[model samples]
Target: MDNISRRGLLTGVGALLAAGSLGVSTASARSLALPASKRFKMSATTNEFFRHKPLWGPRVMQSFAFDTPNNRLFAGQLRSETPENSGDLTLSQLDFSGNVLGHMYLTGFGHAVSIGAEAVGSTSYIWTETDADTTNGRGRQITRFPWQNGKTLTSASVTKWKPVSGASVYTPAVDQRFGRLGVRHARSDGMYINVYSLAAARTGDFSTVLASFKQPALTAGIDFQGWALYGSYCYFWEGEAYPGEPDETKATSKLWCYDINAGVLVDSFLTLAGKSLTYREPEGMAVYGSTDGTARLYFGFASGEPGDRRANLFYRNTLV
Candidate 1:
């Protein structure tokens, strides 16, 4: 398939290209039979992402989302290794096996903590954090823009939308099966997740929130990693990459579950899958609704050296 170029796209349809948001539609959200007992397990065998490498920027895969309609995976990463360029972000287009297909750049975007991917007809739009805070390289505004391969689009060049005001930081993720978009923010009191219909969020009208709940706390020193929202359940990361080589001494990454409806913590488990990876560090989490109508919760890990890193993705397609 030829990559469509929208480097000149300037609103919801033209500029940001609200792919799925152009029309009001709904798909009944389905649960993957995640344990309501808070005892989530990963008994399913794991599969790696075929050493998926980004076409540009730091090879670290910070966050990713599935372009279900296109059978593709979109990943987010920092564009540079220097501190002065930390605010820049990059998007890599890839196949489900984790092989690079194409790429684009989003300069002055946030830390690339999370990104939303939507495919409409022949166009694919990306939802991400923009308007870098400068101080810490975090995004203060959420924005959507069409994916223009080989093009560099700046925050000021695109339309910026802060779904919630007074939040110190903002990041976004998309759930294809549920047809929802979630923007997680950090406020004075605590972090919170605000979910909205994909149709409403794309148009900048968040007056009606589908779900609002406080984010679960993280381990003291664990870096806040990737996240995803499916139905009313929230899954987040709780582990960091090992410094050098990941070996027998390396720690297993932890994935936790939060029930947004009941507003409580539900499940937590350490995954030993991919324990053999080098420099094993947990990064992104995405719930992919396969073409066969089955839901798979994908968790990613970063490996290899700094300049030559590879993304190792694994998923649980069955209940544990």
Candidate 2:
């Protein structure tokens, strides 16, 4: 297939793209079928990235989303090692196997707490949680961008980005088929999952809260990091803080599953023990598969050492 640039895609579509917003139906709650722990075995780890770079690591790879239509994976890199107020956001474009293809550096967006991507025809839209600073009680500032493909995002593209009306949600996972945005919010009681209509929310209208429920097991202080919604299931990371460990990498990581439509806890298990990877501080997660029934899950690690050649370990496992 020839590469079709986003600009060419929009130009070719004309008024066909004008068809707007779809109505959202409420998801019914039901019992979730848990997956067996033995199903996920340790898989291969990819090459290391951002090794010991002061400007990057400590918390380099934070969040990622799969652009299935484009056959690309987009990852959010938080520049936590940099000075405060100096900018701490970057987006990396990658292949299915986790190879960096391009990078977009976003300045003044604060820390990228979460990210969701949507591809319209060929144009790509990125919705992200930049920071936690509240304006009018919106817990975090959520921004959306229509990226024009380039080696790097132009200043014009950055300027054209707009804000989405959501507050306090840290994780944004896009279900393009249903046009819904599955997000995770922290509450005093527990971790809550809410699905909003993407079509309605884009127009600054949020009448559709597709699904809303709390998962008490995601207890307070158990950091809910990476998240991805696939089919009827929502997969997320629980990088709960470890005892006597200041570095997040030392903390163990686990994967939790929820049936979004059924509104029930399906499965929870620790990450597979990879040969070269320890699955520590797993942050960003993404699901990629082909139509022929082949599927794999990808995960990004937060910390490790360049000396051990395991500084930036990212893993992929067959879904079977």
Candidate 3:
């Protein structure tokens, strides 16, 4: 069980300082010019949220993001503990040291495949899948809501957005550097990623999009685990769990880099970053935009047995 704490009264000043460091005004309404995706190499690893069980289902963590403004991380897992044929979710809030400080429940929200966390001036918001489908319990729309500790929110309580008309199963990603938000969605035609201004996206005005591109079809070999949109590059995380007899050498994950601006598949690499963990299954992805120009691409994994499943977060930080 995690201990939840109330914030201090002096958050306003901290929030403003955080916003300045994040390169934003009260609202992130402007875009910043950054360099192109370097097709960077996976350098080192940081074990964030290692072997931590979530509040709901003790389930495998599916997605996560860094709440830079508040200096915390928000992680989510599917709520399949009950036989409701539901898409409810449980989100855990953690400090940098992997200590869970709080939690919130999301009803009728999809498998939490990917999540985006944004905050300004002490108020934090979560961006993820919502309006779940009854059949498979996947999300039909992307939604946003305030981060409330110890609170359970339903899909009806928040507004949902459909980036592409008639598109379903939407998972969102946020890059605060340029105030960008992107969603990977499936439509009748095919799967696509649409990027928009975070400000415009919040107000339900998706017009004047920044970038729209088709995601590369997954090859037969790679298992699709998670994805993230950082700057002009969209990254895909792929890896399967180990078989009954676990082999660390065989337990490997891959990161695929697709340059959205160039409209090309930049490069990809099969990684054994956390190969030592048992049942090492790759899960969610998020990008941490640092002011130093090193955009850290972070991802998560599920390890251990079913009843004792835990979340492990790793990142590829330095560019080659």
Best by TM-score: 3
The candidate that wins on lDDT is: 3
| Candidate 1 structure quality by residue, lDDT tens digits, 9-43 | 10111212222111121221211232232222444
Cα error, residue 180 of model 3, in Å, equals 0.5
Residue range 210-304, candidate 2, lDDT tens digits = 55654324322345456665655666665532222244344456666655555545556554333233334455676555431434555655444
Ranking by TM-score: 3, 1, 2
Q: Which is the better candidate, 1 or 3, if ranked by TM-score?
A: 3
lDDT of 1: 0.68
Local distance difference test scores for all models: 0.68, 0.49, 0.69
lDDT of model 2 at residue 237? 62
Ranked by lDDT from best down, the candidates are 3, 1, 2
The digit string of per-residue lDDT tens for model 3 on 1-320 reads 01111011111112211211111121122132335745445434554435544434577777888876677688888765643338788898887666678889899988777899888768889999899887756689999888989999999998988777887768898887668888877655445678888999988889877877655544444456788877667787766776443565565477777767656555676677666676777788887755536467788877777766677777777664
Better of 1 and 2 by TM-score: 1
State candidate 2's TM-score.
0.64
lDDT of 1 at 123: 80
Worst 10 residues of 1 by lDDT: 1-10
